[model samples]
Target: MLVNRDNPARSNMLAHMGSLQQAAYTRPIEYQEGRSHGLRGIEVKNGPLRFMSMADRALDIAQIEYRGENLTFLSKPGLNGRNQFDTNGAEAQRSIMGGLFFTCGFENICAPYVTPEGSKYPAGSYPMHGRIRTTPAEHVGSDAYWNEDGQYVLEVSGEMREAELFGENMVLRRRISSVYGTSTITVEDEVTNESFREEPLMWMYHCNFGWPLLDEGAEVVIPSRKATPRDETTAADATPWNEIGAPVDNKPESVYLHDLAADANGRSFAAVVNRRLGLGVVIEFDAADFPYFMEWKSMGSGDYVVGLEPSNSSVHGRGWHERRGDLHTIAPQATERKVVTFAVIEGDAAIDALVARRDALLAA
Candidate 1:
């Protein structure tokens, strides 16, 4: 007769954990019930980056700040309320799965682009476009890895990336295996999948910041010569005009200006003021990577959080050069990379630095 250990419950729990590890790594695995919905496992290390895996579905990241400082997520499965809704309405609602970093305008940029009579844009708007879903599903694969170097990496290929929390650090690497080039993202420290058969087009990087980390007082500074008009037909004509474009420049953080009349060097800059939270956020982009900067202030009244999106193409699937004829194009086998960084700064440091940078760029 085998004797039971001093703590029978402890022994059983250990045995259960061992079994789970074995099953999880058994080459091919399937999760049932609750495990399928919540995070299957989490890897904690470094200062505060938490890596999460949901069954076999997708991957997400949580920052250790803001209570856990939940900052970022790469959601492909469209968790809870995080799925993209129809662009037909004003201020399209973001997926509730969490905070996402990238959104593609399959039909239109803000509102579904249509003829003055209300007809939708042609089908080519989302060429080869398919549904982006969580990992562990068919044809969808996700990987979140970290080494001793303290550098963490997360890749979301087949589909898309989302924001689960307000202020976190999440990094994403995009691969276009068929094209031979890949785009990688390195974000603030806390934050899924899809298919292929068609090449990708009309994708935008939506970076969201809110209260505390990105309060109402946030300011945006660009290094471009000017700002151009944003393509949302309805919102385009609003008082103070919230949208603008830019001409490409090679300098870092060069996409800080705004354009209203679609001029080649027309870019502008602005600051975000949140009266409720008494905070601010500063945004800067690379003109070469993103030729336009669209400024949006939801004023904390609507579901909208302030966003400084860097996009490859313009609304309605128009490339930058379409208007200026100088937009960039990426070949199937070519890869392009863009970087945007946000740090917590107090008082006038953020605004001061932004102003100096903009002035220097304009002078040069």
Candidate 2:
């Protein structure tokens, strides 16, 4: 059976099925207002896992909690309760940093970049991480129903467009889903260029971790042969790239570029584990679309968090991409799809299993 968020008959049918198959009704999704940080969002609960995606913001995953404990990091001050376009440039970017996850890039550029010599941007223009995060999602919708195996599933989907009068026209259609009885959330996104001209496309999934899960002794595990620091500052502490430090008063942030080892299916995984807490979070994604994995470590007091970012381009601006000849372009009317899955691994056994998977992928 299927249920459409706007269809009353389908909704009633879903309710009837829920009564008939109570065991399959473990997934519950709710449309909430003034949720985390006073922002509107959709809350989905599946077993011991729950997540909230902000509807008023960039549709970023605002919170992810397991067993009543938040697994994701939130900014200290919290959501600003404002629209993306309400502010301009850097101010807009800083305002949306409160969420656990936010997308970057589509046009203009991701990362801080100076206008290239032949670029359309004016001279001395510095755009920090594309405007996509600040662009609110449109056509938001949610639905829940039983799958063929009688297991319930919930999904929230939306579309966001980044366009200007004579600028790039790109549309992103995103869907986040979860199945009952599981601690996993899957995100599938399709970015399309709806304009007549080809456009540069740079995107990154900024997934941040914090608090109990990111405390002392926590570590990041990835199947990579080599790691490169973003600059000399990071290179100085390169040996501890996989380790988390105790929060300090004014510790500087470090960034690294990981060349992951993927399996035969082009799939790779990374995880942040805290053995003392007996909990961890794993991110599995396709290496074809996002070949670069970046680790952002910020252990300063009141701003302690680690970001596991996967992207197609470097965190350096578009100019760097152009210089490196790694800039990706999407043709007019063409669409590109990317999929990522986030799952929680609990207990020593689960953590070991994740480690084994990474090892196996490396061995292959």
Candidate 3:
């Protein structure tokens, strides 16, 4: 139970409160004005962890917070409706609603590049980070229920289709859920290939942290065997990449690939924590499934954010993967599943626990 939020006895908690919203719940909401006007979503509150699950934007998350401290970065695009932008080419970035959990792919990832000609898909120019983020969802719904373990669960789910007349036919079924009295969130997704032919599939969980929670001297801890800078600029001063300083006037975006350590279950974790703020975020995933972990640090003015990206492929674009002959593709009618868990670490004790766990993983 959540102390002031809930009682020790589930019977007493239910006896006092008529609705679940008093402690943990998901409420439907619609944007009234601005760029987000007409957009529909649901507010999820599971103890100290809360966020808006955008129903129209492929069920991506925005406005993530724990204990009222903002954790995710919201770009100038704001929480605009999915209809506000094009899903292909470089145009996707113009109206990109870059909230916390931005999903990239089904087609391409990283930079925009020309894809090689497939049997059906001709040689074409793919957009930066692909077209999935702006794609609206269908069959969106939210609800709360009690599990067998006696924990209350709140969830928002929907499906998004990335398709064209003669293009790759992929559908993403996503379920984002959390339990009562917990500061953790889980995102489970199933990407199905509906096309008759095997289709290209590159996916990423662009989980971003920024601002007050990511101030000067914040640290990103990862149990990795090696870390490689994305470019020459990043390699120049890569020694201090783990400790992020204050934002600069014109600092360029630098990314690092960390070959993470995994347990027997193939699970790996990476965290960004600030002791001064008593706040932190841990992004955990299966290393065997999503083999590439990109530590993205963009300290540019007004664009400061750190992304703990867990992806199935590298930061290299689709063209690079094609050239390397390791472009991953899924068989027709097959499904690719991914489950990511995010936990908010609070207080010195919690931070210390995280460090100990990370260290154990490193030693293992």
Candidate 4:
């Protein structure tokens, strides 16, 4: 067993080499067929990552630390330490802070969807949606979330199987039905533990898309006449919280409520244009589902991409509702569902097609 294939001292080297070659390309053993052995029991600590791709399926990216469990590449790093942006440096930092960059379809991190009241939630208490964690029983580190079901699913496309993130698992199961007009996938994930004592938690999608795939020439086209001013209570450009507030530099997680007083209706659409590449993508959400849309820009040196985020809550937290006298609460065992969709376009023609659709909807 310890012999090398080309060991000069071994008389059987030639024979062993031939055997190794045969083993390399021979059909896989029967046991390896169609088994969901999928990706179980593999430990990753750092560096090298395993990417699993199946025909006509979503790419399953597994980045494991050499000696540890898998890590979720969602969630943005805080603007503290290395993650913080230097005010005078490259504006891209504004976009990159908080580990939010990736080439995935888009990252969806939810829970306590937006900010809590200043006095109640505080910076220390802001509930971030995604985290690399481990359960006491398995001690295997993975992302955890409340009311999560129908989140990951193994699907068959052509000759491949993909892991997809479909919405709610029960009666309301939803998914990214189609992408780029060519592929369809469904993801399912369900977890139940007694310790998850529930409360009204925050939830929001943390999607990152970029590159020659999404580039600097890319821009966001939201169907809003005005953006709610960034809440000054916590942001650098904190200002009064109102519908008709000034045009402030937008930041991620900043609260943006519908400004009905503006010409456009609360129900607006947003699109991202990668003009140089002649590609565009549009995201549409109803104010009824996500009442706010945030345009997060990283003004410091970093990658240039736009965040067209739609949220159910304001960045000021439920407390803002209290201040405005609009706070609402959900009791135990209560579940709320939100849905958003993205469609890809090919070039200026595609952008015009989307714009035409938007105009038609508005006209109707």
Candidate 5:
């Protein structure tokens, strides 16, 4: 039976079946200590999805798998296991490239910027992405329970702070949850400024796709009125940005900025569909929180992956946003909240329904 978010009865029914399936297949949610490359972390599994977050590293989602199919790309020399705080700028950036999802930006930098507006530190001192991905999350906890509607919910929550003796004082509280019997994950983040002054807040969700799910013939669908290529390298490949190519050796990566069209609720959706495999993943986010959408297409043989990034700022560095007065800032003691949801759509009917939703939003 198909579960519809708008139909509570159907959803409950699906949840019931999911609970039964859980008894036969697995638990609703399982958390256990996991070690990768001698680094310790926590692995969480809900239904058919599994993800890992290292304690030694920042709060990045290191790996994700659905039904034994690896949905995330893991580059060579995977999971360095090095504590992010101990690593320098270059090392931090290199370690991030392998994870399934890594956050970027907070106060000092995002995308490697050298700017005077940055912390009093000199240019090129801030990391490529901000320290959030490397700044470990404390107060980590997990729970699973049956809701009033009889739906089982699995959740994990944690807090990560970025601060120094005389630097930006910001804290982020994050929670990731999934419902039993569903292939959906929701990530909610609340960032607060604890300092006495306003602070620049830049953030991007780097959701990467790879391997069989990102193989040849897969297409990225976004309902956008216009898209801007980041540079000539991207512009040259913009003609067919919706399509994916076979793994080719030495193919340059392409980046594009999309001006998305949203629904009445100010929410936008994007998806990567592999029709041949009858599988796809959909990302839904609030445009009010993430005003920009960026796509990263790396078709290189070993580095073949695509990123569906939603951000408050363009993929451009902090300096660029500051110059254009586009940087997001939170007043002292103020907080900002954002939410993003990921769901797996399988089979022709489900995929078609997703496409229909996209078309409807575009038509509106």
Candidate 6:
């Protein structure tokens, strides 16, 4: 379970607590203020770790914290209600709220670009990262209980669909699950092509870390064989690609495409740790499913954060992806599944252990 603390069992913990909320639980909520009004959400807490997912935004993780420390970066853009979430004038890049675990792509990803005329996709601007985040979820549900394994389990599941007449139709079913007293939460997603025609798919999980969890000395531990800087300037800069830089004024973000290494089971772990803080965040997933990984280091004064993105394809425009002959597609009615686990590893020992895994991966 990779939980924070281990008790005799769930029964032992349950006996002391008057209610599940005292230790672990899941609750449905609604944002009632400003642009967030009317947006539905579900939050889950297990021990020192707690996170909330937006039911109105493809159920993406909107917040995460540990021991009252903000583990995710939140922008000035208050949570925009359903209708207010438009990418006009680069709103997402300028002011996105739950950037904590922002999801990109149902049809498009990366920078806003226009598909060529007479292309398979309608020739027009794809807008920033598609419409999945603004789409509301349906059939939302939450479950909290002690399982037969004697472990308290928390789950929130929902379905989100993005469709347009004479265009692509994709349905995403997501479930966020965690165990009581554990520091980890797993996100399971299944995306299906509901349209009759084959559709190009570009998916990426944008997991961001904020100031407390991310600092000047914090280092990212990933199993990358090498790195490819996204642009000439980044490539020209001799600063090591994997190193984290201190936040500075007008420090333009640097993006890198990493070539990852995985285990026999295709599982890989990427972590950001600040030994000084004795805190770290570990992300585990199947690299075989997500072949491409991008590191977004934005140490700007206001939006200081590091984004660990696991993607199915390159963030280069859809037309570029197609031209490269690497654009993945789902056959009509085909479904694909992706699972990622985010865990909190605190203390020197835990952080060291997690770093050792990356060391071993690099060696392998």
Question: How many residue pairs collide in each prediction?
Answer: 65, 0, 0, 52, 0, 1
**Alpha carbon lDDT of each predicted model:** 0.34, 0.76, 0.83, 0.33, 0.75, 0.81
TM-score of 3: 0.93
- lDDT of candidate 5 over 248-333, digit per residue (tens): 89989998899888999888888888888888888999888888889988999999889988988877777777677767888999
Looking at model 6, report the run of 10 residues with the lowest lDDT sum: 84-93
Question: Which pairs of residues have clashing backbones in candidate 6?
Answer: 3-182
Each model's TM-score? 0.48, 0.87, 0.93, 0.46, 0.86, 0.93
In angstroms, the error of model 4 at 151 is 20
Give the alpha carbon lDDT tens digit for every residue of 104-151 in model 2: 786544455556578654354435667677666799887777655555
Residues 1-364 of candidate 6 have per-residue lDDT tens digits of: 3543554775576688888698788999998898788888888888888888888888888888888888787876767666633655255554466446877887788777677766666655666776677778899999997665667789999899888888889999998899876788898999999999988788988888887878888888888898899997678756575566777888778888999989878899777888888888888999988888998877778878888989898856577787777778899999999999998888999977877777888888
Best by lDDT: 3
- When 1 and 4 are scored with TM-score, the better candidate is 1
Question: For model 4, what is the alpha-carbon lDDT of residue 150?
Answer: 17
TM-score-better candidate, 1 vs 2? 2
Task: Arrange candidates by lDDT, descending.
Answer: 3, 6, 2, 5, 1, 4
**Model 3 clash pairs?**
none
- Summarize candidate 1's per-residue lDDT along 101-180 as a digit string, tens digits: 33333222433332233322223322211122122222344443332332233433322332223211112333311100
Regions of model 2 farther than 4 Å from truth: 1-38, 83-87, 108-110, 120-126
Model 4, position 65, has a per-residue lDDT of 16
Looking at candidate 6, what is the lDDT of residue 62? Answer: 83
